[model samples]
Target: MVSDLAAAIWMYTVGPWLDHSSKFTRTGTLGGHHLLLLIIALTGFLMLAALAVLTDNFTHSTPMLAIARNVACVISVIALTGLLALILMALLSRLLFGPLRP
Candidate 1:
């Protein structure tokens, strides 16, 4: 938890710095919909994976912990599924439409 907190703090402090840096925008391949889909897919995968790990970790513990984790797991899975579905739809649209030009 402390590590997560530290990482969060670091990102909060450094994210804007990275964003404002001249190298940030030009660092990656600039695509219109392709870049957006990549970001969405990345977030969707990460969220689902994190929630799965948390759910697994919380299992086989105290009764309260089990109950809370179960509830949270269900909610998280539902939300993640919805988000991933949207990301999937976006990807499909981009694939069908071909890459957009700036």
Candidate 2:
């Protein structure tokens, strides 16, 4: 997770910001890298949610624990669905934009 976050920051955030405003002419807009970073962040958040539920798995027995676990599962599913949708949107935009610029 830490590596993913670091890669996302480098590949998507700082890299693009430099390319956009660096010592050169530019016709920049928010592009796929930003979207991809968002997708990565969302994925990490969803993973954290899953880890929370998994950690709660062996809690012997408790009503509130079960409820919290179920809620986390549902929220994770929702996050997953949103992640898929974001991925599809990114793909479609890439298709429309053609190959990525150097």
| lDDT for each candidate structure | 0.43, 0.49
Query: Number of the top candidate by TM-score?
Result: 1
Clash count for candidate 1 is 0
Where does the lowest 10-residue lDDT sum fall in candidate 2? 23-32
- True lDDT of residue 60, candidate 2: 55
TM, every model: 0.36, 0.32
Off by over 4 Å in 1: 1-60
Off by over 4 Å in 2: 1-59, 86-102
Q: Write the per-residue lDDT of candidate 2 for residues 1-102, one digit (tens) a residue.
A: 444344344445554663466332111112334445445555655565555566664455367656765664554454344335545766887999987886
> Which candidate number would show the highest lDDT if scored against the true structure?
2
